[model samples]
Target: MRKIDAADARLLEAVQQDAHLTAEQLGAACGLSPTAALKRLKRLRADGIIEREAALVSPRALGYAIMAVVMVTLDREDRGVIDRFKQDIRNTPQITSGYYITGDADFILTIVARDMDEYDDFTREFFYDRHPTKTFKTCVVMSAVKTNGALPVHDLAQSAI
Candidate 1:
């Protein structure tokens, strides 16, 4: 791993908050020349500090009004079943995110659909047919108080020592 100084940490924080910021703008914020700033940004990417950048899309605007977190518990303890489930869920676009967790559930899935009917159809056709197991769901994402893709680089830098 590359050693990141205070300047690099500041640059990372600034860019993560707004990737669209130009090198000159970022330089001004972090106390570096435009040329130096661009070089540092390139170095960060080369070091794998900055991953691919992407736009955050709203689910509501995209026709997916319903958001649900489904906890799936597999009947069998076989690893093959879990592997198959992971692959199947990856292929299914409705399941945005899935995690293999500990406790009562083997996997937790985050799903978004047009409405309850669509979610029901997905559960019946996709989930039920492939893996027959017990599931518990919680449907309350009333409001997203805080959602950020940015990581806390300052804290990470402090801890690196």
Candidate 2:
């Protein structure tokens, strides 16, 4: 990885929070001129330090009021089966995020649905009818106390030294 100086680090932190910040604003935050800030941002992009920007959307506003975390255990020694299951999970729109884990479960999935009834339909159609999922468990999220998109830049900067 490319080593980032304090100014670059500050720019990254500020941009992660608000990518819409003007070059002048970012410059003011980092004590650089607007032209210099723009140049540094360009270099960051060229070096792949800045990957992409995205807008975080609220699931409730999008008609998905329930959030669920599902742990899926599949039959071992079946690569084809695992791949098929992954593809099926990816194809389902309700599944927002998924990861293949190294622990007790083969995969973990984060899902969003309108309500319990919608989740029930998803479970019956995807888990019961369509796939070869062995054992599974789900935990409904009562509340998300804290969430942030920012990376731990301080820790990363320390480790890089």
Candidate 3:
């Protein structure tokens, strides 16, 4: 892992909150000059400490009403089956996030749809018709108490950063 100072931590924390912030603004927040801040930011990016920046769009605004948590159990646990499932899931856009999980389900997926009908179609197309899966269960999300949050950079290393 690359070593980072307190200034770097502060910079990361600031940037995580707002990626569009100017070098001057970030420097002011992290107790550095604009030039120094930009240099540090560039170094961080080069070292792979800072990943891609993105804008989070509202699903409701885009007319997506339903969000479902799907638990998928595959029939086979072989490498070929797992690999193929991962590739298929990666190609599917409706399944936003998927994890090869432990416990009851082999995979957990976060899916978004316009309504129940659309969701049903997705299940029929992906789960039943295409893949060889044993069982699939879905839990619709009513509301999000807390959706997305910034990573805890400050708490990670007080001494180093």
Candidate 4:
């Protein structure tokens, strides 16, 4: 892992908030010269600390009106089933993210679709007919109270310096 200093931590925090910032802007925010800031940013990207930068588009604006968090309990927890299910999830674009979980559910998925009809189609294709899912429960999002996708840089406080 690349050693990140206080300046790097400050730089990371600023960039996470806004990835579109120019080198000059980043330097000013992080108390570095433009040259130093650019160097660290390149290092961060090369070391894979800063992953892909992408635009966070609004699902509603894109006509994806439904967001569902689904807790899925599989019929079997065997290695083959788990592997296959993970692959299936990877191929399914509607499933934005999935976590292998503990407790009542084997996996939890964050899904988005155009509407209830599209959501139903997804369930029919992935859950009801073909998949090994035993029971799945969904909670449709009424309103997103918080959607900060940025990871916390404060956790690196001790190590960063």
Every model's Cα RMSD, please? 2.6, 2.7, 1.7, 1.8
Pairs of colliding residues, candidate 3: 6-161
Which 10 consecutive positions of candidate 3 have the poorest summed lDDT? 152-161
Candidate 1: regions farther than 4 A off:
158-161
Clash-forming residue pairs, model 4: none
lDDT of 2 by residue, 1-161 (tens): 89787778778888888889998999986679989998998999999988877887888899888999999887553888788888887888899888988988999998999999999999888877877768789999988765556885643453221
Question: What TM-score does candidate 3 reach?
Answer: 0.91
Model 4 Cα lDDT, one tens digit per residue, 22-121: 9899999778899999998999999999987878778899898999999999999999999989998899889888999899899999999999999999
- lDDT (Cα, tens digit) per residue for candidate 1, span 5-122: 7778888999888888987898986679988988999999988888887777788889988888888888775988888998998999888888999998888888888988998888
- Which regions of candidate 4 deviate over 4 angstroms? 1-3, 159-161
Cα lDDT tens digits for candidate 3, 1-161: 97678888899999988998997998997889999999999999999989778887777788889999999999888999899999998999898889999999999999999999999999998988888889999999999776655777776545652
lDDT of 2: 0.83
Sliding window of 10 residues with minimal summed lDDT for model 2: 152-161
**Candidate 2 Cα errors over 4 Å, as ranges:** 158-161
Instruction: Score every model by TM-score.
Output: 0.85, 0.85, 0.91, 0.91
Cα lDDT of all candidates, in order? 0.81, 0.83, 0.88, 0.88
Q: After superposition, how far is residue 83 of candidate 4 from its true place, in Å?
A: 1.4
Q: What's the true lDDT of residue 70 in model 2?
A: 95
